[model samples]
Target chain A: MEELMDILQEFEPGVDFEHCTDLIDGKILNSLEILSLVAEIEDVFDITIPTVEIVPDNFNSAQAMWNMICRLQEEE
Target chain B: MTSYCSFPFLFLFLPAVIVVYQLMPEKKRPYVLLAASYLFFWLISGTLLVFLLFTTVSIYSIGKRLDREGEKRDALLKTAPRDEKKAIRQLCQKKQRRWLALGIFLQLGILLTIKYSGFFVENMNQLLKWQQIEPLIKVPQFVMPIGISFYTLQAFSYLTDVYRGVTKAEPKLSRLALYMSFFPGLMEGPICRYRDMAEQLSAGGKITYHQLTYGVQRILYGMIKKVVIADRLNPLVQELFDSGTAYDGGLMFVALFAFTCQEYMEFSGTMDVVIGTAQIFGIKMQENFERPFFSRTISEFWRRWHITLGTWFKDYIFYPVSMAGPMKKLTKNTRKSLGSYYSPLLAGTVALFCVWSLNGLWHGAGWNYIGFGMFHFMLIVLGNFVEPPVAWAAEKIGLNRDSVPWRIFQMLRTAFLVGMGEVIFRASSLHQGVQMLKTMLTSFTLGSVKNGTLFTLGIDRHDFLITGVALFLVLAVSILQERGIKIRDYIAGRKTPVRWMIYYSAVLFVVVFGAYGNGYLPIDPIYAGF
Candidate 1:
């Protein structure tokens, strides 16, 4: 989760990831930033991401994304 | 008077519909909205209603097929053997894929033939004739259907979304129809998406008094922007560009600046009207502009101006190109060869090129538009390159981004950049654009103003006054908006007498000041040509 926050800092500096649940909803992360974040998340967590779950709602917020990462790790 | 939005229709047709709609049962509201929308389209577009109907039925049916195929494919993938599942999925998807392609191709084909055939044919004829050969093609005149480009794009986006499983296919035919031809968004679009607007279309949500009042006030703001600032700026812009030989550098530059403001106020103001109208029906449409003139760079200019189109390009074109196999491999290869820093830049440039070129082409089919795209691409990429330097310069100058003068300077700089782009955009041809550019650099003067150059463009004192008043209204309204004030709240707080008076006064002003009577050519809504 901390690593995820670091990656998001690239989108807009000084973002408080803890406060954001509507990342996608609020358009805080554009599509390109999302792609970059996905790559970083995959590398950081050493987990593969399926393309099927790349919908906007799943990544709209930091919490939603954190939960998604947790779920994938549990499955592993 | 012939415009569906004219006095008689507003005073009679719209009010009657509203009265009857409210009197009717709530369950039948969707049907009523559909009827009213189609009737508006039919009345305004006449026989072009057939085109709207055709699009509605074809897209509606195509959505149904795509949804079924998606369901079948998902089911097969879960249970069948890998080979069998793959084969079954491909077979099921093929027809659906073709149907979607056919729908988009047909829509674009119709748009091109109607909108671009004359220009295409004329250029071909000129080229052949210059070679002393008999011209193979002759240009034909075609009356383009109003709102065809906008609605076609909207329908295509909706269908494309459903096909991709980004959103579900809307099941109800009438609801789909309403979504496509919803009166406010039909003529010029913020390009509403199915996933974004579907729920609003199906259900007429509860409207707060605040919303009702703010909606009407916003409409007033939009009307003033259109009638005053935009219409006023049109004449000088036309004259200077139409005969560039007559103006010196200073006047031409001013003309260009004025045109930029005119275009922004005109288009964005129209959007405000569209959003306001939707708000009246408790529908929340996407906002299309956000004080784009205040952008510090060309990239920010795009983000702030015509924002929906920018997002559409990013989502539909840029993302796909950046992530697609070839581009992905290029990014990977760059990383392998040049390292990570170079990879993102390489990918970003390719993505930017695709998006910007498409953006340029989306404005119109011309070399000038292509140039317009390249020009902005250069600025944005260059802005990126100079980011560190610009930051250092700002720090050295003790300039804060939040400072009033800095903000104003950015706005002025953006105005200059955008104004030059409009010169090319509004020019008749590349040669004319070049000629205008040259004249802007060389033959400049304030003498033309003293010699009645302004009057010769066709605007008079009345036009200037209306423009001035309209601009004041727009600025006042925008200030309120910036302060987080919604116009509806103010109107909602007012007594019924005050509210009704405001509405009636707006109607009167639009009727009187709007450029619709004799001696005025009804300019087709500009984006419709796209």
Candidate 2:
């Protein structure tokens, strides 16, 4: 989780990714930020996220994103 | 059959549809609507109704198959051992993916074959001639079925939404078909999403007095905009845009601005009719325009204008393409090489390119249309690039970026950008667009207007005055709406006499000033062709 926060901060500094559950829905994490976050998550966790998995429900919060990473990793 | 704004549609078709629709049982109202919608499509598209039916059947079948596969997968995953679950899910996904791909390919294939084959063939033949090879391919002429671009996108959205588990496949094929061919939106659309519209379409309701009055008022309001403003500007726009070299730069600029206004009024006016017509049926379609001219940026303007199409592209195309594996990898590599600020923009830029290119091509299969897309793309990209530096500079200069004057300045700048793009859009060809631009830059003179050169165009001075008054009324209403005052609701709150006075006057204005009858040719809804 610390590692995830670090990656999130590195991608978009000053954003409280740990708390902002509406990151995607609120437009806090825009399309570009989401792309950057996805790239970082994939590299950090070594999981290939299918395109369908890249939805707001899966990436709107840090916890949601972390859960998706874990699930994809376990599948792999 | 004329457009929705025509007397025939207002007096004949719509009244007939409404009376029939109202008399039907609530459950069977959808069938009435479906029949009316098909008749509407058939009237406009003639034999091209086959294409709409083909789309409806194909998408419905694909959606059902996808739903079935999804259900089977979920059921199996529930019973399978934890260790085998991932494999089973993947297998199911792979199969479902093929179906989704097939659905998309077939729809896009049909769209491209009918809409773009001539352009493709012509360009290919041009290339062949350029390379000193014999140009053999003859461009095939096809009368594209009306609203194919719109309905296809709506259908594609449904299929993809179901596949992504965003929404379940609509079980009833008739319901899905009605959603696809909903008459109000069948021609030019606000482009309803399945999730937004499907249930509303299926659940028919009795029209309340409020719905009926509000719907008629809205339709009348749209008619005023279409007839009083847009249609009046048509001949001048045609004259100026067509004969670019013959006009002075001042007139050219006037023509360009006129075209912009004409397009907005016509397109948004048509949307008002569509949304209002839907409202009378107690089915509230999404709004397409929200006073786009009031936007402070090209991007914001896009958000306000043709709003659904923009959202559709953003949701379906931009998001997917940006988050795809290749784009993710590209973002990573760019971040490593070019640093953070620049790298974040890379994925967005690529996705934007796709969106804009498709957006431009979606408008029409012409170079000018593509140029229209590229024009906005370049502006947006440039805006993104310079934003930080511009912000820093503004801060350094103690400029209040949020001040009213600055906001107004930004709005004008955005309008100027949009106007230039519209110039390209309105031009007969790209070469003509360039010529228009050149003439505008070179031959500009304010004296032309003072010397009554404007009168030499189609509209007389008295006609101009009427158009001016109508435009001002529109502008005033737009301002009020922009400030969060609901003009319709406010009027609805008044006493019956006052409300009736407003309604009667509105009707009177449209009747007196409308550009119809003997001399004027009806301007088809501009976006309907697309």
TM-score of chain A of 2: 0.91
DockQ of each: 0.25, 0.52
Model 1 agreement with the true structure over B143-196: per-residue lDDT tens digits: 766788778778878887887778898888888899988877777788888888
Per-residue accuracy of model 2 over B284-399 as CA lDDT, tens digit each? 89899989998888887998899899988988888788877777778888888876667768888999999999999999999999999999999988987888899999999999
Root-mean-square deviation of candidate 2:
2.5
Q: Which residue window of length 10 is worst by lDDT in model 2 chain B?
A: B335-344
Off by over 4 Å in 2: A1-29, A40-49, A53-76, B336-340
Task: List, residue by residue over A1-76, the lDDT tens digit for candidate 1.
Answer: 7877776675568667788777776767655566556556766787655544566767877778888899777544
TM per candidate comes to 0.86, 0.94
Question: Which pairs of residues clash in candidate 1, taking residues 3 or more apart in a chain or in different chains?
Answer: A23-A60, A24-A60, B213-B488, B214-B487, B214-B488, B248-B443, B248-B444, B249-B443, B249-B444
